[model samples]
Target: MSLRDMNCTFSPAALDAPDVASLLAELDGWAISGARLERRFALRDYHETIAFVNALAWMTHQQDHHPDLLVTYNSCTVSYCTHSAGGSLTNNDFICAAKADALYAQRAGA
Candidate 1:
């Protein structure tokens, strides 16, 4: 199954550098900066940005995995790392990253 199709369960292990790099390739507009998987979505305006944030919030809430979001007037920067795994990047990060990409695609119609 695709990452987005999979659910995030409790995992205490962090992904290794090679695994993280491989998974990062499967995600669009996402990059690895330190231990976090990061992406920035550019929206038309504040309204769209907030809408995207709220939608993403709900999705993450359902998965029980929250991301650090930097919101602005026209963009939202999302960063994900597993605090439960000692702030390292885990499989949950990539799974949620794929879901976030799907959300952005549907919301932005891109």
Candidate 2:
């Protein structure tokens, strides 16, 4: 399914009990860091890494929310947090994380 693009103003509720495990599994490597989801991406080079960050920036802009992005010569680390919610996770974090995963998969053809 496509990543949710609607502005998710919903608060973080305990996901349906049964779905929690599956969702956690999908986000295994990308774990909860601080108030959001965190993931690291390793690219082929600086150019590819920058390209990836640019794409992510565009997505973030479209969503009207931003993430904490750390870009290096060949790696990019992303952390999604909703400041208004204090130090807590939210659906927006997961939505953005899933979108990033989709983008990575599309770029890697995997």
Best-fitting candidate, scored by TM-score: 1
lDDT per residue for candidate 1 within 1-110, as digits (tens), equals 89999989897489888998998988989998887899999999999999999999999999999999999999999999999999999989999999998899899545
TM-score of each: 0.95, 0.76
The lDDT for every candidate, in the order shown, is 0.92, 0.71
The C-alpha local distance difference test score for the whole of candidate 2 amounts to: 0.71
Error of 2 at 77 (Å): 0.3
What lDDT tens digits, residue by residue, belong to model 2 across residues 13-43? 5344345345546664687654457899888
Deviation of model 1 at 37, angstroms: 0.7
Which segments of model 1 are wrong by more than 4 Å?
Answer: 108-110
